[model samples]
Target chain A: MHPVSLRKIAKVYHLDAVTVPALAEVSLDIRPGVFTVLSGPSGSGKTTLLNLIGCIDRPDEGEVIVADQAVQSMSDDALSDFRARHIGFVFQTFNLLPVLTAFENIEYPLVLAKMPAAARKKRVLELLDAVGLAERGDSRPGQLSGGQRQRVAIARALATAPKLVLADEPTANLDSQTGAAIIALMRKLQREHDASFVFSSHDPQVRAEADDVIFIRDGRIAGVEQRTAATQERAAS
Target chain B: MNTWLLALRNLLRNRRRSLATLLAMVVGLTAILLFGGYRSNILYGMETGFVQQSGHLQVQRRGYFLDGSDNPSAYGMPRYREIIDAIQRDPVLAPMAVVVTPTLQLGGIAGNYSAGASRSVVASGLVANERNHMLQWNDYDMISYAQPLALEGAAEDAVVVGTGVARKLQLCAALEVANCRQTPAADAPVEAAATGSPAPDDVLALSALEKAQQPRGAYNRIEMLAATASGAPNVASLTVVKASNFGIKAIDDIYLAMHLAQAQKLIYGAGRPEATAVIMQLRHTAQMPEARARLTALLASDFAGEPLEVLDFQTLNPMYRQTDEFMASMFGFIALLIGVIVLFTIGNTMGTAVMERTVEIGTLRAMGVRRGGIRRLFMCEALLLGAIGSVVGLTVALMVSWFINHSGWAWTPPGYSYAYLILVRVWQDVPLLVGSVLGMIAVTVASAWWPASRAAKLQIVDALRHA
Candidate 1:
């Protein structure tokens, strides 16, 4: 079964009697164990779509079902619980809390999930090691490179072992090489954990690394491409 | 593990801002403590003065206060035993001494030997020991009145003159009134012998009549002669022995405690040896209230048919109330001013804090923290600030108060001739201190409400967008 499904999702922003559609009748499905990239220019509703799937934002008129539970019908508290249980998110700005170290940043989601401190610490250390940042765990985000910070962000997103992880422009602020490295790390992590990775991006490198791609233009999906197993085997070889 | 630690960390996230808030709280608290302490001290000092100088209560003849002429013998408490018994029975009451004395208000001419001039002076008769007791309570020790010095070949009738009279007369020890007497000059040969005498017997008698007809000063020497009421003279001589220089110097101008027995005998009569009032001395002033109540009850029961009045020091000295009222008003004004300043400081600090954390608050809300949690976080911060401020301020205030008390400042209220060197009083449970501290905390917490509620109600999307 698909991990996330959006049916006829519409989002409208009302600003001073002007009705501007942020997302219009959008419908999509996200399956497990796939790196799906939504590629669009700015204001193309890619981030809006990601927000809806992540349960951080609800559709104005339509249904959002994640892991077979209708998210649009859930109350705010229920949505928060749903998000904590099934979804993880990474922002474009690498929005790390300045006061927290890399390890603490990774542990933040588990804390939100109300996990046991000892378990959280163990999971945080494991994730830090997996992200090749074990040495930098105690260093603040400000003291790390862009690649290392993005690695920390990805580790934080994966801390709770959520079914779906959404990244909004995760490589927007990194150098091309660092961005590529971060994308590679995310893809590797996704494969190892069997977690579905959905990211909105305009970076070609990020788009090239996707197992499937959804092309969006002006708040509507233009095309959808899926890499078959044969194609994955060829790319791997 | 506690969310409060997270809240505290958030406060310290911006070091400069947090320091500013802390500094403001410290200042507000310090001012509150100092002003509060000082006001409490003044009030306590005045209360102590009142309690020490005047017994908590006094009892007198019911009519004595109004008419000022109630006779002591007329309203004497015959049931004094019952009064003492009642006082002993009440646990909350303490009993002191019961005494009786006489008082008189008289105006008469006072003369000096050297000038032979007399001035009108006011005289009051007091019981000697009772007067001494009153003076001692008033903190006066060096007080004196005269007893007559012996003179040979002189009239026994004599007077103890006041310092004012002594200074005016220029009379010293061993001075004789007869030597100092001023006689009217011959009066022009007694008006030329008041027409010529006719015969030897007539001539002698006429000379005696002429001498008698000449105007003479009332007496060669004036005396405050002690006598029986029926005009039988009992001569007793007195001289000024010692004097007092403190506590109402004008008291030296008036005679006091001139032998109540002698006064009563002289003023009323030998047979009517009665007093006008009673003066009581007590071991402690605290015993006065019960003693007064018991005495009043006793008098009412014993002298049921008679009219009497009771008076304490408060009634005798109207200045006590005036002084108390003035001090209270002054303290009240100071408290009000301090309260206003503290409220403003706390409000401003909390407001500034809210303003600085707009984006952080928005982020937390977007992170799915409940609005109630947000409110709790802010309120907790305010409470923390208040608690710290109160503690630091109180310590500072206590120290300042201690220093001021130990510094030994000399203070003199208006209309008083003598100055007192005293320390500031300390009253730990003064209502103002407790009320003000609580008031400060309340003000601080309430002040945080508008800003905290505003933060709580912020739209998550817009807050996340806040820079």
Candidate 2:
């Protein structure tokens, strides 16, 4: 089964008395173990579509299936449990809890899963090493650079060994060098963990490295592009 | 991070605001405990005084309180000796009673011939040695109220008049000086002629006007006169040995204490022994109910089918009962007021903290923290705050109480003529400590509920966008 299957999903938001359509007839199949990027200009409903797939919100009219379970049929608690067990999320702002150290932030998802402390500790150390911040495990989010914070958030998102990692503008706040490094780290971790990654971005560099780039415009899927391995390598260089 | 650990770290984020909130809690708690301690002290003092003044239990004829006012000797407890013996024989009662003494109350007139002053007085005849020693342990002024018993010195006819009675009669150190009645200093020792003929030197020093006041050189002669139980006139021309200040305005105005036998003979008749009541003192005031129950049972079994009533201090002194109730109500109101202020302070603090952390809350929710987990985190924070504040407040309260107790401050309650030292009993007060601590914690948790729930209910999508 595909990691995510969206069939004609639509969402509408009401601001005061004004009705605005954020997504309409958005259909997609995100296969496992692929680095997928949803690319569009501002207000192209890229984040909205990502939110629907992550189960943070529901669509106004459509079927949302994540990891072979239809989320609309699940209760709130069941949906949260499903998300805790199978899905991970990364926000545009990094959203790292300020009070937690890098290690603790990374271990948070495992803690929510009620994992054993020894295993949690082991997994958190591994993730810290994977993110190239093993020496800075004790540093809080505030003490880290933007690239370092994003790395911590990325490690946290993969802590539960989720089937899919959904990221919204993960490199939005970093400089060009830091953002490029973050993207390389995410791609490398995606390959190492064999997890499908679906991230939204307007950056051309991100679209170039994507195995599949879905372009959305006016709340609809405007086009799709498939990149060859050689093209991806050429774009990365 | 664990939830509780995260809560603690969050609390430390705004240290100044948290500290201010903590201080409010500490001050509120300390005020409640100290005020409660003060009231407890007052209650303790009043109870000890009342019980010591009129023993833990008093056994009197059934009608004594109601009808004995007109003819007190007529309602005297005829079987008082039997009741005392029974009290000693009972296994449950014998250990409870420390002192059991019979007293005779007589109403009469007292005259100071040297000062040409006379007044009506209420007299009590007590077993002198026991009565005098009992007063030594009393919480009232030992100097003013109990010192006069020493002057009697086995003189059966001598009397100790109340200070109010003495002031009214103008009986002074001697009649040698004029203006002895011009508002005599109330604290002067009762120095007068012996309970016999005066010394020649003392008589010689008397002014001519004093001489005219008392003929036959019996210048210090004070006469006590009362009617026998049969309504026949009886008189005892005795000398005033000393006077006492009983410390109660109503009692001080008309009190006269004499040897028990003399009072009995004067109020009833020669060779006739009678007592108005029997008073029982106990080792501890808390043993009142048990002791009273045992004594009353014994009294019934000994004098079965007799008209008698045994009463505790609370029943005897209804005014003290009312005063205790009033104090309890007043303190309750104070505790509630303090509790509400602390609750609102904590509630407002938690509310503001939750409002400021909307985005953080959203992040937590998105990370699979359940609503229940969010609520638990806030509740845990409140509980920790209460626990810390209670410790500090209780510590300060105890320290302040110790300081005041040892500071030697004295206060005289209204209607009491003598001053007593201020004291606080904290260690002995388990109920106050437990109740205050629990009450504080309960109020703190209760106050955090609304704010925590509000935070937990915030929609993740909206909270993420909060600035």
Candidate 3:
């Protein structure tokens, strides 16, 4: 079964007196345990589609099925619980709580999930090591470099071990070298953890690394491309 | 997860703003407490003064309080001694009544024979020891208003006159009254000289002609003249012992005190002696209702068929109630104003915090924090602010009270002749202290509700894009 499925989902935003269509007629299925990329330029409804799939924003029309539950049929509080358990989010700005340390930031979602403190501490430490920031756990976001802060954000997103991890232009703010390293790290973690990883990015490095690439334009999917095993091996090369 | 710790960390994020908000609450609470303390001090002081001077309760004839001064002899309690005995032996009043005594009131003319001057005077006759005991009543443990009468142990002819009376009768120098200024127009036998009327104050001349008599001496002595029960003129020679001020000029000008015999001899000569009022001092002011009720019952059952009434200190002195109400209103007004200022101060601080943390709120909401959870965090911050502010405010208030009490500050009341030490009483007043502290903290917490609600209702998508 697909980890995230959007069937004819539409989202409209009202900015004062103007109503703009952010996404329309978007139907897609994200296969589990694979790296997928939603490649689109700015204002192409990439972030809007990610928001709907993560259950943070509701679609104006159609069904958003994430983790086998139609999100539109749930109450706000129930949707929050569902998100805490089944989906994680990564923002382009690396939105870490400034008042908390790196370890606490990763542990925040587990706390929201009401995980036992001992288990939370264990999971947070493991994720800290996986993100290559085991020594930086005690440092706040203000004290970390841009690359290290993004790594902490990724660790926090994966702390609850959700079935789906959604990233909105995850590498938009980093340099070419840091963005490549982050993409490689995400790819390695997805292969090992076996969770569906969906990123909204137009970067060539991110597009080259994905097992499936969906092209979107003007809130519509223009095409979908799935690589074979040999094609994926060539892309890896 | 420890939400309180998160709230504390958020509070510590902007230290200066939090400090400013806390300072507003602290100052507001401190001002309210100090004002309340001052009001308590004033009312307590007034109560102590009245209780010391006249006792907590007085039993008098039915019309005595209103018209007793018109004819003190007519309203005299003839069976006062028996009534005093009954009250002193009563079951309820026996434990509460510290000093139950009888006093005689008379309106008469006092002639200072040696000075050759006389004036109309209002006099009270009492047992010097009993009056002296009544002078020491201070139930609130406040500054003492006790001043023992010098008439204690003195001869029956001895008397105590107010400083105004001394000046009125031209006895200031003789009484050794410092700063005594005499207006000559009110003194001397000037009325007779100007109008050619028989000098009404010529007690010696009148004594010889109208069969009036004085004691055979030319010392510091006065002859009290009053019409007896039969309307016959009578006189008793009194020796002046001490002159004391009664604080109010009107009462001081005509006030005098003498032994009961001297007063009875002058007013009820050759007749049954009586007292105009019986004074009963109690252990505390709070026991007034029970004392008044018990005394009323005793007056009705034991001393039935007699026209008498029970009057508490507050009733006898309406000035205490007026002053109490006036100061209370002033205190409440000031407290409300300060509370409003504190309310808005805290609300503004929290509102600014919500504005600054829009993105953080969006991030938190996205991480599965419900709206109620967002509201709870801000409320926790307000509770912390209130708690800290109340404690520090109480400490500051107590320190201020202590400083003022030990500083020897004194001010004369509106109609008083002398200044008293200014004091602040709060700690012993449990209701005022606790109420003020709780009210302060409650206001602090209440002030944050609007901001917390607003923060909780923000749209997560919009908040995330605010930056």
Backbone clash numbers for all candidates listed: 12, 0, 0
* Model 1: interface root-mean-square deviation in Å: 2.7
Candidate 3 residue B43 C-alpha distance from true site, Å: 1.5
Candidate-wise lDDT, in order? 0.62, 0.80, 0.85
Q: By lDDT, who's the top model here?
A: 3
Off by over 4 Å in 1: A1-3, A66-86, A221-226, A229-237, B57-84, B91-356, B420-436
List, residue by residue over B1-467, the lDDT tens digit for candidate 3: 57888998999999999999989988898899888998998898889989987899999999898877647677889989988999989989989998998888888887664445678898888898988887788777887755688899998789999888787666776688878874443234433332223435445654544224443433456667777777776777767888887777677789899988778887787689988889999998889899999999999998898899888888889999999999989998999999999999999999999999998988888888888889999999998989888999998989998998899999987877778888888787788899999999889888999999999999878788887
Write candidate 2's Cα lDDT for B422-446 as tens digits. 7766655778889998999999999
- The DockQ of each candidate is 0.21, 0.61, 0.63
For residue A37, model 3's alpha carbon misses the true position, in angstroms, by: 3.6
Clashing pairs in 3: none
Candidate 3, number of clashes:
0
TM-score of chain A of 1: 0.94
Best by TM-score: 3
A103 Cα displacement, candidate 3 (Å) = 2.7
Q: How close is candidate 2 to the true structure, as a TM-score?
A: 0.86
